[model samples]
Target: MRLRSLEGRLTLLLALAALTGALVYIGVTEWPLPQAFAWMQEAMGRHASVFQPSRVDIFVICALVLLPLCWWLGHIVMDPVKRLLRALESAVASYRDGDFSISIALNRRDELGDLIHMHNELGQTLREQRQNLAQRELLLDTVVQNTPVALVLTDAGDRVAYANIAARHLFNEGRTLNGLHFATLIADAPEALRKAIEGTEDALFSVEMDGSEETFHLSQRAFRLQGRPHRLQLFRRMTRELSRQEVAAWKRVIRVVSHELNNSLAPISSLAHSGAELARRGDVQRLPGVFATIGERARHLHGFIDGYARFAKLPAPRIAAIEWKPFLDALALHCRFQLQGNAPSQPGWFDPVQIEQVLINLIKNAHESGSAPEGVTLGLNVVGHELRIEVADRGPGMSEAVLAQALLPFYSTKRSGTGLGLALAREISEAHGGRIALANREDGGLRVTLVLPQSATAS
Candidate 1:
C-alpha cells in the first residue's frame, strides 16, 4: 500500500509497532539471555547464574520497551493532524474578526491537506466579496459627498448622524456636523429657514446672507435605518432657478403687449392719416367714414386694455350658498351648452358672481373651439366635499406642447385670443381654495374641469 495516504501511513505504523513488540517478547522470554548471564557470572568469579530474570520481570521489560516505541510511532503518524487543528482554530478566529486575507498552505497527500485547500478557497472567496463591498461603499460615498443638494440624516434623538459636504457648509461653515443637535445647529439661522425646518411639512424659504437673498426648497423624510428610526432632510437652492423663470415670464409679457399695441396703433395711425388727408382735400363725404372707422378702432383698443385691467385687479370672492337651478338657468342665458348631468341639490358655497364669470369664459371657449353647439357639454357634480364642474367639447384636442403652457397667462392658440380666459379662470379657482385640470377625451376633444371646495369662503 502507498504510505502517502493518511490511512495507509497509520496502518503501517500500527503494524510495525505490533511486530516489534512480538520480537521483543520472544527475545526476553525464550532467548539464551539466562545462559549469557551465567557466562557473565563465571567471568566475574560467580559459581551460579544469580542474575536470571523471572517471568514477571521479562513481562515488565517487554511492556516498558513496547509502550515507548508505540508512543513514538503514534507521534510520528498524528503530529500533522494536531498541527492542522491548531491552524484551523487560528483561521476561524481571524475570520470572526473580519480578516479574510489569511490562507493555509500544506503539502500532503491526505485528508488534512484537502481540508486546508478548501479553507484556502473559502478565504479567497471571502476576500473577493469584502473587496467588492468596499468598492461599492466607496462609490456611494463619493456620490453622496459631491451632490449639490444639502443632505442631513438625524437619529431618533434628533442629533445629526450624517451630513454631506454641502450640508456642512450650509449649517456650520464647512465643519463636520456629526453628533450635533439639529435644533441647536440651526439656532443662528434665519427665522424663515428655522420655521421651515421645524415645521411638519415641506416648504420653500428665503434667507438673506451678505445682502443677497437665497431661496431654498426643503424636503424631509422619516424612515428606519440600521434598525433605528432616522430622518433625512434635503435642501436644494432655487434662487437662480426662480430668477431665470421670472425673467422668462417678463419677456413673454413684454412680447405679447408689444405685439398687441403695434397691431392697434399701426391701424389707428393709418386711419388718422387718411382722415386728415381727406379733410385737407375737402372730401367731407369720405372724411366722416374715415373718422367713424378710427372711432371703432379706438374702442376696440380700449376694450382690450380694459380686459388686462380687470384681470390685474380682480376683487376677492364674496362667498354665499348658491342654488343650482337658478345658477344654471342664468348661465344658459349667457352661453350655449347642453347640461350633461343633474346638478347636486347640495348648496355650493362660493362667490356666485365670480363663479358665473369663470363658467361663462369656459363655455365661451368651448363654443369657440369649433364644436357644434350640441356637442359642447357642461357637467356639474358634487364629489365628497367638493363641487366639480366640467366643460367638454367635441373638437380637436390640444397638442402636448400647447397643453403644457395653455394655463399660463397670455398663452393662446387663437389668432385674436387675449389668452387670459383660462388664466383668469385658474386664478379664481385657486382663490376659492380649488384647482383646475385640463385633459383630452379618450375618443376626441378636450375637457376642462374646475374643482372647488364646497366649504369655500372669502379669503
Candidate 2:
C-alpha cells in the first residue's frame, strides 16, 4: 500500500494522454494535410479544395496550446495528490517502524483531506491509550515484585509462565521460573489441588514447603490472569509457627507416655509391696499369683514401649525385585485371610520385608473388621506403571469419623488396639514410592489399596 500511490497512477495517465495527443497532432501534419483539411476529408469522405495553413505552423500552434493545457490540468490535480501521498507514505513508514510521531499536514478541504485527518486522530488516540496501559502495568509489576508474598501465574498448559521476585525466591530458590512445570515449583501439591488440576473443580489449597530448610505455609487459589486460567499461590514463612507446633507435639507425646507408664507402674508398685510383705511374713501360698500379676504388667509395659519403638525406628526401604508367584504363594501360606485376584506376570519392586509388614497390617485390619477368613479378599493387579494391591472384607465398614483419623499415629477404635499398624503401613507405603487409600466399599466393608510405582520394580 505504501509502495503504490494514487498520485503516481494519475500522473502516469496524464503524461500518457499528453504524449498521445502530441503523436496524433504530428500524424495529422505529416499526412500531407493541415488540421482543417484532415477534419474536412474525414467528414466528406473526399479531399476539399480549401486553402489551409502550413503543416509546420499548425504543428507549432498545437504544441504551444496542448503543452500549456496539459501542464495546467496536471498542476491542478496531481500536485495536491502528490503532496498528500508523500505525507501519508512518510507517516505510515514511521508507524510501521514503531515511531508513532506522525503529524501529516494535508491542507485540503476534500474527501481525501478528511481521510488523512481521521487517520491522524486515530494514531494520537492509540498512542495515548498505550501510554495509559503502560503506566498501569508498571504500577502493577512494582507492587507484585516488592511484596513479601510469592505470586506464580501458570498458563493454560499449567506451566509457570510468570513468577514475581518473591515467588522466584521462595519456589525456585531465587531462580527464574519460566517454562517450569507447576508441580516442580512446589514440592508438595496438596490433594485438593491435585484433584483440581484433574478438572474436578477449583479449590483452595494449603500445603507445606520446606524451602532452604525453613518451613513455609503456602496458600493457593485458582484464578485467571490476563484472560487466561492460572493458579495463584501465596507463601508465608512458618518456621517459628512450625517450631512451636513441634514443641507442642513433643509435649503431648510425653504426657501420653507419662499417663500410660503411671497406670502400669501404680498397680505394679502395689503388687510388689504385697509380695514383699508376704515374703517378710512367710505367706508362701499367695506368692505365685502376685508374681504372675507383676509379670503380666511388666510384659504389657514392654509391649507398649516396643510399639512406640517400632514406629519411631522405621528404616528406609532397600527396594529390590521379587518373584511375584513365590511372593504371593508365601504370603498365602503364612496369612489366615483368603487370597484372591489374578497372579501378576511381572515382578514387583519393593522391600519384601517392609512391604510384608504393611500387608500383614492390612490383612489383620480386614480380619478384625468382623470378617471370616473366606470373607476377606486380598487382590493383586497391575495398573499403568504401578502395582495395586487391595484388601477387602465383608464386614461392617468404618464410620466416617474413624475413617478420617484412622491413619494418624495412636488413633484407634478397638479396646486393645495399639493404633500404630496403619500409621506404620502408610509410612512404609510412601517409602516404597507408593500410597495407601482407605475407603468404604459400595456394598459393605472397608477397602484398602496399596499402589506402588512400577519404576521401583525396574531391574
Scanning candidate 1 in windows of ten residues, the lowest lDDT window is 450-459
State each model's CA lDDT, in order: 0.89, 0.78
Q: Extract clashing residue pairs from model 1.
A: none
Write candidate 1's Cα lDDT for 285-378 as tens digits: 8887778888887898888889888999999989888888999889889999999978777777889999999999998888888888898999
- Output the number of the lDDT-best candidate: 1
lDDT of 1 at 319: 82
lDDT of 2 by residue, 1-459 (tens): 321355655666678777867676766566535666768867876655655667687777677767777787778676877888898888888888877778787655566777888988978987888789899999999998888877777787879888899988866689999999887544465564454445533333444445444444556677777787877666666667778968876776676678779878999999999999999999989999999999999999999999889889999999888888788777776677666756687778889988888888788888888886688898888878888999999889899999998987767787666668898989989888789999999998889999988763352
How far residue 287's Cα lies from its native spot in candidate 2, in Å, is 1.6
State each candidate's clash count: 0, 0
- Candidate 1 whole-model C-alpha lDDT, 0 to 1: 0.89
Task: Indicate the residue-level lDDT of 336 in model 1.
Answer: 90
